[model samples]
Target: MEGHACPHEDILETMRKLLVAAALAGCALSPLTAYADAPGQSPAEKADPAAREISADQIEATVQFLADDLLQGRDTGSEYYDIAAAYVASRYRAMGLTPGVDGKWMQDITFRKASPAESTLAIVQDGKAKELELKTDFITGASFTDQLIDMSAPMVFVGQGIHSPENGIDDYAGLDVKGKVVVVVSGAPKGVPGDVAATLSRGKTKVASDMGAVGMISIRSKSAMESLPFEKLVGYIEGHAEKWVAPDGTVVVDAPNLKFSTYLSPEAAADLVDSSGHDLSALLDAYESEEEDAVRPTGFVIPGEVKVKAVSEWEEVTSANVVAVLPGSDPQLADQYVVMSAHLDHVGNHLWEAGEDEDGEPKDTIYNGALDNAAGVATMLEVARVIAENPTAPRRPILFVALTGEEKGLLGSEYMAKYWVREDGEPVGVVNFDMPVLLYDMDDVVGFGAENSTMGETLAAAGAATGIGVTPDFLPDENLFVRSDHYSFVKEGVPALFLMSGVENGGKEAFTNFLKTDYHGPGDDLSQPLNWESARKFALLNYEIVKLTANADARPMWYEGNYFGDKFDPEGPRAPAPAEAAE
Candidate 1:
């Protein structure tokens, strides 16, 4: 016993000296630092003892600073966003974490922002051309490159335009859409799983492009309209699309084959399909129906040809993703990483003069994304602090990432998922915190993408430890599972979970109200009343999850027969279904 001094004693002694030095220097001590002041605590008691004692004041302070008007919404590729990235780096330095991005605190990615300069669409029927009006009938979009598009092709009707053979439903099955423009109804059938549906819905353009389609025309069903109306879509007609560029200055194009793409209003779509023997209204209704056996159309050749053209303008910009790491105590498992991520960027200022509105009153144009994502970054930082400050480190390294360009269509996260490689190893699992609206005291949390992987069990354990319940998605139609930065990691075969403030104990009302009033708008600022207690609990829950994941014996795996696992990560390890996982 004389020769076997405990390892943690040395760390404790060092911490005590640091605390004394900090006290003498008049520097503020964190909650974990204050907790460590106790004497004679055993090594077992010192390990992650403050995981549940996350400080609400610290979380609020981070949020207040990030969401302040001085930051100017932290828009990606802007000087203000660079300032935010530097702040996050400073926080990582304060926590004593090493830089995760190849000895740098940030990974600066080059991106190309492209918007349509001139776009035109026309419907050709009975050998006659009818030029449709832009911004009224359809709007060209999703083209990330500066290109000239002039294509006149035959039209095909691909019901949902989803090509997921693993899901046993490919809208393109038995269809000859090669070199043709395909008209697609937005939203998947009600029978499809939520996560699958969300991914598939977004993948329509990529599928069309891959299938050699020359052009794409999108129309929304009633259900899709209920979620995202055409009017709301029109607001985004003048695009601000951004895509990461390679080192060679080549812009990334997800749907390259598609020279033209447009989303039609319901009226325009109805008119296009009226003479094709298929009633658009009936098909939309069938797609939205809840009946077990409903009429869902497969692909068909519509009796029409379409002509479209587009010209785009482009500019290049650079943005950074702030990254830090807490090295593992166990050298054997230290190479593998457990990643915790939250987006650091938000939509920029609105189109308006700050000094006056149309009515001669002061206007607020800055989109201060307080609850949209400043809160999420704050929560991630709090978790990082707790984990980094713990006396005992997890067996596996933990990566803390504050990603930029999330507002620009997940460009930052997509870049990281595709290009950011660690010399040690790949990430074992990812926990993404995005837009946890903590407007009220919540009793539960929604774990998106949980059912698809083994992380569900970790989430349950973490929620239980933090005195919160695991709740199902209350607003399923929103397709939130695929909306955030986590989906980018998922696309790269990483098992990930996205946590959202649940719709329980007035949470539904609060979340709904926030979305209606403040989401992506100038209203998401510090003036709103936020429940700091809930923010503390949310941070604690995510920290517990991160700790459990990093310390687990086996890496997180996709459930056997899971659609996402089978489709995206076919070769990764597999686990039993969640119902049988424990056994």
Candidate 2:
């Protein structure tokens, strides 16, 4: 029989002792090894019916095709991505899944893309203007509602510019930033909850706009400088910014009240606060200090009028999200859906600055996102195939979605999460697969958002049945709970869970190496040593989760007083934690 433990000599000896002990005591043994292939059925497949239909070879084939160089990285709204979407749709049809969107297998989304053409930023003080060089002091600026920006306004510094009553934080407690440019440091304070801090970091722009600020200039904090250096940040922002267009032909700008927004280097940020009676270095020291009592910078006015002008090149592009459904057998529970999703897009090739190989031939700039998302889509597809082929349909209908524009801030999922619901059926929960990093024989899995809803219990049950350990998020600083396609569903008040390979059984080293070496780079191709066994295990785990959720008597609900639950679904049904519920 295949064993559950890795095949190291030391582990094998340990497992042998455990098995002997269990047999002597007449205790029933757990399933045999993870790779058991006993007589046309593995032990895992026997325990999990859905696992029988999932083929690791099929997952590999799907990833090989989607992450090929010919696909040009599957950028959203591009022809290459359209081909990928069509491929997913074709797979759904072949699996005998009905269309999810009113007989249509796709949801079309239009987006307005804006790329920076040129910009000029200057600080006018003492009747003299000091112009900042682009790409040196300031990166770029964009305004979704305007093609050109020309304004000069007084500048105000509001520290981090956060305003969360729940967190007892109000950076703008007494500041009036009306008609002024708000200068603030990026990210939240260290003591805030990781998930809540992530939300506050993104809410700065909206806070500034709501306070009648004309523009916003972000200065990277010490943490940002260490995690995402200025050069790396520039590389990320050099491309075009995209916003989905609504059905009414209007683009939804979150901070529509603001006309311009840009980021500044730390050096440039220090220069702006040179004569403002506050030492930038001292303020930053306190802001990032680890002491028990560290004072944060408060709001203050800068001694300058910041004049910034920008020109944007705008274009309209379209993309589609592939959707499919497997209806349930139970008429009552079938009215609700359990959603399984993965993004179908990646950062496209940077064609403008394409380089050359040793032979002077054009170099490979295609990002061929093998692990960033192509593998995630492949895993979701295998799960869908297994569920669709099950002899008895689940009690609740299952909706399989291949979302688009995930690399562009989860646009596709956002649209569907907000507006794709039907009067007859609603999505009760989401299980998203994104960048599972299946490069090692994983021993455990990390369940993001597991603690926020009843899905935590479902995840626990699924893990136990699959002989996989469930672990907490080891890298909470990454704020992964709010960083994937599943967050879109969470924002719309649906309970969601994102499971990824955890940092155990050599996973930490492998995952860290991947982030440093290949994440978001051309090196993320198929040349890497990816573990097919790990991929199969992950797919089987998710399949088991779906089976449990779809067949459960009651729909998943938010745990009472959870931050995300209260914030997004204030009036939705709430329950005690799973452990408490049993009591």
Candidate 3:
């Protein structure tokens, strides 16, 4: 929708031709076939009487409503987020699901917001000092307290400040930067496996934090500095805007205080180091050759200083989570809960940037995050509808949760998992749906974070029931396990499973291409082709699996040696065996 215009005329013509062709062939149309039935018979015939039937119309309606422009982008703490939350809650109410955990449908959370304001960094070199802007020049070192960080402290040059005992490397083994500002090269340690960019981006702050330095200044290499463009800068500003402002008109926290952290022009960093009477190139060469950790504390310390004044404004606002419950048929099992979750938030509207509509006025661009997560939330709503219509309730209570702020570090799930307690004080296992729509037919469904529990076997068997195979992640290094809400449950010692379509048999290539080109971008719209049939199959498969687990004689437990396996111990893998071995 952002780049290519939809060929509405062409699509209409194609549909008309197909209809005419079907009429000429005297083909009898069946809703079941149009929805998701196996070959040779209508879906109604093949479907188990106990299985809840979901229609394609429901999926379409849900997607349309969630992705509608009126909802904006559903960014957390924004007006759009509140609207989306209300929509989800209303859908749950219409489906006849009672409130879960509490009498209310919302679980509130607290968070701290911070931003950089009026930051100045100056280096006194040869008695001449120059100041740098906050973001354009540098960020801050990690510090939880507010203090005037004077540049008069000694400066230690640590090359690629990394200290990983697991990797047998410690960049700061002999350096003492206590009360001193440390300067380090930004990048990953040499020979680190995986994408250097991703690793460095996520690991740099932690690495600096672990070094116990007063403050850190990162020198960006020429190539790295050159890679920063206007688009990336604007995206960063837009995405982080909410994190700097609270919904209420109160500043939760001041900006962080550390030494001046910034990317200096290669020449600027070199000049500063050289002006301090140190051979910058030689120092780098020696550090590179040493292999082990190396630190060169130049006797000449440049007294760097910084002043920061950050102000945050907020407005009082409120949002909610959608909670619904399906009571179990078995009175005893009804108390145990099986939770299905998906976030209902997305990045919201973007202010106009020199753009005008056909009417010759500035136009606002709404993110309309259809695939980023709206589709997943829509699928959850449809699932709730189907399950509510089932002939008999599941053996165990099923809770449907449409969470918020998933983009904001899974905050909604974290709050619910941490605070929402059962009547008996037991935590609930979560099965979260995220990005369930697939670009093409999937022969296998990939399960992420399955190693943490025996739910992997259940998931595999569930897929097998729908004639779909189960596969482990082909790209585990991507860390899909920790990327979704399921990780929150696993962290709390609750067994959880996350599902994705398998990459085997070409699905991998398709999925990879989608991730690279479409993920999190405006291009991720509903108009993009998706295999609805496969989605339906996936929903039904999960329904069966959740139903079986809910009705099980015992609660689901973690497998031996699993990530959360220790929590269910004494009662090991066999405590609650699988309903059946996966084919």
lDDT of 2 at 165: 89
- Write one digit per residue (lDDT tens) for candidate 3, span 191-238: 454232233434555565555555666666433445664334434532
Which order, best to worst by lDDT? 2, 1, 3
lDDT of 3 at 515: 84
**On residues 5-78, what C-alpha lDDT tens digit does candidate 1 reach at each position?**
23677757644653453333222245555435556432322455676446677787778767766567889999
Candidate 1 — number of clashing residue pairs? 0
Q: Against the true structure, what is each candidate's TM-score?
A: 0.90, 0.90, 0.71
Q: Which is superior by lDDT, 1 or 3?
A: 1
Residue-wise C-alpha lDDT for candidate 2, range 1-583, written one tens digit per residue: 1111234786667446534532332221132332345464434578764576666776777787788666778999899999888888878887789998889999999988988888999999999999998888888755678889999999988988988888777888788899999988888887887888898887788888998998998888887899889888887776689989999998887798889888888889899987687888877776787665777668899997999889888899999889999999899897889999999999988676476668976666778899989889989988887788777789999999999999989999998987774556999999999998978988799999888899999999888877888988888888988899999899889999999898888998888888898998888887889888789889888999999999999999999878888888999998886665333
Q: In lDDT terms, how accurate is model 1?
A: 0.82
What total of clashing residue pairs does each candidate reach?
A: 0, 3, 10
Q: Residue 38's C-alpha lDDT in candidate 2?
A: 46
The best candidate in terms of lDDT: 2
Residue 59's lDDT within candidate 1 is 80
TM-score of 2: 0.90
